[model samples]
Target: MAFKLPVHCPSCETMLSVSQLSCPECSTVVSGNYDLPLFLQLTRDEQDFIMQFILNSGSLKEMAAQMGNSYPTVRNKLDDIIGKINQLKNKNGKDDD
Candidate 1:
């Protein structure tokens, strides 16, 4: 099963859907798809990889050594995650237009 984050309304104490954008304060139901924050959206494995990468000071070689993975594997995972983040950012920007 895919993981999902819980959202809540600040005004009515109601559980909100991930697509929600407005609270009862505005008396409006915001429309369209909503995405989770980038850090939260990442899978556990990706998050772990990122944490290790950061601890290694952006050194892919060190990350590979620490994770017992090849340099290419680490690089590919980083690239994939970065691409996802960029895509999400672009999508959000387009939505705002």
Candidate 2:
């Protein structure tokens, strides 16, 4: 099963940071303030689009067909995601990768 990661606080629009991580097997926990990756900071829908894009062999035309959208629309969506990622990288002053 897939769990969605919450990237923002519900009450405020401010960006959120990860403060802890746990190991399910060893029952060990690690904690610290960490920013979400540029990709994870994107909206869920955008993440899904990226997954679909990869599954389609990086073909926007294939993604459009699978998503029932026009090729241009799919390309535009990808372009928008790229812009957001660039902005995030600039804001962080580092590459999320």
For each candidate, what TM-score against the reference?
0.58, 0.90
Point out the worst 10-residue segment of candidate 1 by lDDT: 88-97
Q: For model 1, what is the C-alpha lDDT against the true structure?
A: 0.73
lDDT of 2 by residue, 1-97 (tens): 9887778898897889999999999999999999887888899999998998888899999888888999999999999999998998999899656
In Å, residue 5's CA in model 1 sits off its true spot by: 4.4
For residues 16-38, what per-residue lDDT tens digits would candidate 1 score against the true structure?
44666677786888777655565
Q: Kindly report which residue stretches of model 2 are placed more than 4 angstroms away from their true locations once superposed.
A: 1-3
Q: List the residue pairs that clash in candidate 1.
A: none
TM-score (C-alpha) between model 2 and the true structure: 0.90
TM-score, cand. 1 vs. native = 0.58
Candidate 2 clashes between residue pairs 3 or more apart in a chain or in different chains: none
